[model samples]
Target: MTDRTATAPDIVTGAGTDDACCLFQRALGERFKDLPRSVRDLHTVKGESGWQGRARVTRGKSRIGALICRLVGFPEEAEDIPVSVTIERRGDMELWRRDFGGKMFASVLCLRNGEERGHITERFGAMAFDIDLQLADDRLQFPVARGRILGVSLPRALLPVSEAGEFEMDGRFHFDVQVSLPGIGMLVRYQGHLNPVRSDD
Candidate 1:
């Protein structure tokens, strides 16, 4: 699906800019171009950006899973859930703050260091996850390569399973993310569409 032209000068459309490519572009390398413009436009932004959307959220039923979800600020089950996101550049990292029906949660994203170079690291409090990305057809996937808490690595069996990605449909940006744990059946799964909300909005 083709993306609408951005009237704002700060909006990023594609490559060949005097400034370096954004985080996703740098990590995906040559495969970045394969993504649909709907996905590319959101990831290519260089500065602070805002997005507004709606989602369907499903929270885990397990007692322990519910507790964990609450602790992590995961939103309650709902359809057509109001969603808003803000992405801001902080040094070499990008801070993503999301509000799902006013249940706010945020994380820090940055390229991993050392042997895990090229991969992305998403940190939530003291827990950090190393994500290995894959591109399939017109979709971008994120799989946990490694997970650590308080600087200690977690066993693979203990790590949460994630089925997450961003895709394009009918010229709009869409996303699906389902996270589950070893004992917990499901933590929270949310799928939705996002459209850029310019500063003037």
Candidate 2:
């Protein structure tokens, strides 16, 4: 219900010069211009911005899946839940905070260097996933190609899997993100639409 992004005036600094501030554009290069207006705008993090929307938060029914979701502060199963997202830039890292109803979780995103070149790395708690941003049919897809726990790279077959993407429909930015473990099935799936919060709202 609260728009923390609008109030975080100190989140952006003029000196912060990280491509992650505008992650998609950096990765897609000139092709970024071909994306839908909504998708492009939502991924462009300038300072701290807020987006509001609705989502269906579904936790996997599996025992381990539910436990993992709960441990990561995921929202309980719900439909038409209010969603709020805030993206803040701190140096080369982008802190993305999402609120599903009253429950909130955050992740840090940046461009990968080390071993995985030209990939976007997202860190949620102790798990870090390297995602390759690929555009297909006006959608930006996030494919988790590699994963690490506590900075230690995991084996190839043991890496967690993710099916995520962003697009636009009916003039609103929509996203579907689902992550799953090797044998644990789905971890969580949240699909919804978001619009930039305007001053009038």
Candidate 3:
């Protein structure tokens, strides 16, 4: 997404004092404990040296989607590494494209090493759409066969990481998500944790 209005926080933040990674793990456990009914189960598998897992998403109490995520292609001592995620959904096949791949509605942030690396943002006209994003300082512009873009800003907060390695932060992060469906004039907000993954462990 073109971050024309995106503003960096006045002060960037890290994790809690004990151990940033530990804090992250605790927070994720607490958050997932209350996942919506649409989500059946979420778990992380620790391999000999990395992480991988499958998240199951449900629809009307039936398992209908699965997302496989992994921290592959990272060095052993790499405190900050990249992750890859692939989501697959079943039902109303056409909607899946617009929901996950089309321009009008899609995730705006793709991260590498816990930093915003790229995204898919689009502007749509009824059915046709245009898209753009910034990856490693390079901007890739293109269009899609369907769906439209809704421009919005993402709200963020700072977590203070002290020299002693202890940290804590309090605030809600929000994102302005705009999308145009065939019959829906869309404007909405997506609210979630600023950083979902916590530790390299």
Candidate 4:
């Protein structure tokens, strides 16, 4: 599927020309403008062939953190794995659907930014958490922010950090993501290249 039309201007901007929400939203888009335009579009992009790639996930060194990864349903292995990712823009939020080694995972990301607030839903609201972002020069960092389990906030001290960097290499779009904790070392890191495949969705 292709969303050829542009999404409407953000409603939050109607409050005022210099409202905090409007400022942050514009800043967020400007920071990552080097990426695919669809990344900033609040509309779905899909294809029958989709995007194909490879990923490697390295578990954290801390034993407790590794255990927590298992408990939280993270794959514990550190090896090269084939994967596919499908991203769709739904309203103001984006849905990233990934299939790795036959196990599917999905996350919902809300792009509105204003002082880092609220629990963004994921997996169709089976999970939700607030996220803190550090966006700069085509790179985005998800510094550990407060999270919620069943709407109960988790301690800030226990959250982990994750960051992503995107660029073009060998004429293909490339991205790298790393997850780490203060005392737990690195949780997982994945890097891959993707090229668009044209097809009717």
- lDDT digits (tens) for residues 133-160 of candidate 3: 2112111122222232242322212111
Report the C-alpha lDDT of model 1 over 1-201, residue by residue, as the tens digit: 001111123122333332576777777788888888988888876888888899999988899998888777778899888898888765456778788888788777767872233589887776789999888877889989899988999998899898999999999999999999987788999999999997677
Weakest 10 consecutive residues of candidate 4 by summed lDDT: 1-10
lDDT of 3: 0.21
Please provide TM-scores, in order, for all candidate models, with all chains considered together.
Answer: 0.87, 0.86, 0.20, 0.64
The candidate maximizing lDDT is 1
Q: Rank the candidates by TM-score, best first.
A: 1, 2, 4, 3
Write down the TM-score for model 1: 0.87
Lowest-sum lDDT 10-residue window in model 1: 1-10
Candidate 4 structure lDDT: 0.51
Q: In model 1, which regions exceed 4 Å deviation?
A: 1-19, 114-118
Question: What's the true lDDT of residue 172 in model 3?
Answer: 21
Candidate ranking (lDDT, best to worst): 1, 2, 4, 3
Weakest lDDT window of 10 consecutive positions for candidate 2: 1-10
What candidate 4 gets wrong by more than 4 Å, as runs, is 1-27, 30-49, 76-78, 112-127
Off by over 4 Å in 2: 1-21, 114-118
Each prediction's total of clashing residue pairs, residues at least 3 apart in sequence or on different chains, is 0, 0, 9, 0
For all candidates in order, the CA lDDT equals: 0.79, 0.78, 0.21, 0.51
